[model samples]
Target: MEMNELKAITEGLLFASGDEGITVKQLARVLDVQGHTVEHLLEELKYDYDNTGRGMLLMQSHEVFHLTTKPEHSPYLKKLLETPQSTKMSQAALETLAIIAYQQPITRTEIEDIRGVKSDRPVQTLIARSLIEEVGRKEGAGRPILFATTKDFLTYFGLTSLEELPPLPDDINTDDLEEEADLFFDTFSEQIDQSNHR
Candidate 1:
């Protein structure tokens, strides 16, 4: 097919998919062309989007492609993603969720050790929210339940997979340990302080 025709059809397919854009391999399979051809076409399309004053552009990550509105369009996009009443969790819950996501299959006791406090309430809240779940029981003396992140966690965070999580520094230092401890306290301390204040 002609280049213009290819671009048009590809854009049409992307639009038809809405938030889900056709990957290069999928497009190649559908068009009976090589994957490189589809990739070249996508590159050309991306250039067009960059040159033209279109309201949106294409993005690829975690083996998926998507057409998203330009960041400049956030004010309008907010009208769609925003809700009347937003759901929120305590900071303790957020910390527990992060730890579970990073160190999955870890037991409540391990989490407590990291946080240096009981994590029952936060773990319960995360489980209730479907962000974390009991993966299985640990093989130990007590056989405590192990927790891990759920698919809902990825969807909620707009991540296709947990592998997309940002990389952490490999170095270990006193500052790093102090920061982790501070984070643990900061997460739970505010709520405790607020209740104490009252």
Candidate 2:
């Protein structure tokens, strides 16, 4: 096929892959072209998108290629994400998120220890909301999955960085996580509002 047709096909494959994206080797196999040719097409496609001022950009992560909106459009995207209809976090979710936000790369066990309750459901909820993710595993037995906040977490909270989060008390009272969650949520919500307006 022609170069333009192959480039179009490559772009379609990336789109169809969604968040999972496509790998150079995988694209080569599917396109019946060599890996180097796939790489060339990707570079050319990236250049075309950049030079043509397309709303989408090519992002490569760990050999995976994704077609995503340009970063310059984040304000519009954030507006959609912050709509009032968005799901509000439950008390349990808020507590769990607060702990994770402060003590990130923490395990579910550690979160449970602080909250003094099972955190499986809350962790799953955060993962589903794209607020937190399994960054990796711990060092010890069973090697439990370690969770950390995602970029979406920062976006949703209207924070530029984790440092922007309200500071935790010098002595966090783990015994009263319910009250702690309430206090944190109140402060956190205020910060979010402030961030959005700035």
Candidate 3:
């Protein structure tokens, strides 16, 4: 097929994938082309979109490609994307989400340990919203639920995967023995404040 035709097909596939971009390997398999060819096509497509005056453009973040309308177009887009009918999560839910995001595959007991308070309501709310999920059962007696972020969580946060999470500051040493006590209080204090506000 012509490069132009392949580019068109690739663009459509990327659009259909939404926040998940097709890897060059995946695109090559589908297009019956070399991976390098797909990469070149993607670069060309990105250049075309960038150079054009289109209100929407193709962008790749965390190896995922998507067409995002410019932020300047928010006013026009909001009418269709939002209705005053959306359900906003409570502050408690946001805190719970942050904890789960940083320490996933953790059990409720672990979350409580980190938060120094009960997380039942926030955990339930996150699960109901399809953000966090029971990824597995712990090996211990009674097998407590082990929670983890779901694909919906990644999409909602505009991340391709957990690996795309931003780098943490090197100064914040998570393993420092001296800072352990302070870290616990800091994490739990935020949780308490969120709970009280909710």
lDDT of every model, 2 decimals? 0.70, 0.80, 0.70
Root-mean-square deviation of every model: 16.2, 10.5, 15.1
Clash pairs (backbone) in predicted model 2: none
Candidate 1 TM-score, true structure as reference? 0.47
lDDT, candidate 3, at 73: 76
Cα lDDT tens digits for candidate 2, 74-178: 788677656765456666777788778988899887887777777766776678678899888778664566889999999987689998987777786767866
lDDT of the structure predicted as candidate 2: 0.80
Tens digit of per-residue lDDT, candidate 1, span 1-198:
798898888887776654334567778888888888888888988898888999979887545566777889878756643453425566677778767776788887777677677777788667756789778777755346688999998877667998887544465343454366455445445544554345
Span of ten consecutive residues with least summed lDDT in model 1: 80-89
Q: Give the C-alpha lDDT of model 3.
A: 0.70
Q: Which 10-residue span in candidate 3 carries the lowest summed lDDT?
A: 177-186
How many clashes does each candidate structure show, in the order listed?
0, 0, 0
- Candidate with best lDDT: 2
In candidate 3, position 135 carries an lDDT of 81
What TM value does model 2 have?
0.49
What's the true lDDT of residue 98 in model 1?
69
> For model 1, how big is the CA root-mean-square deviation?
16.2
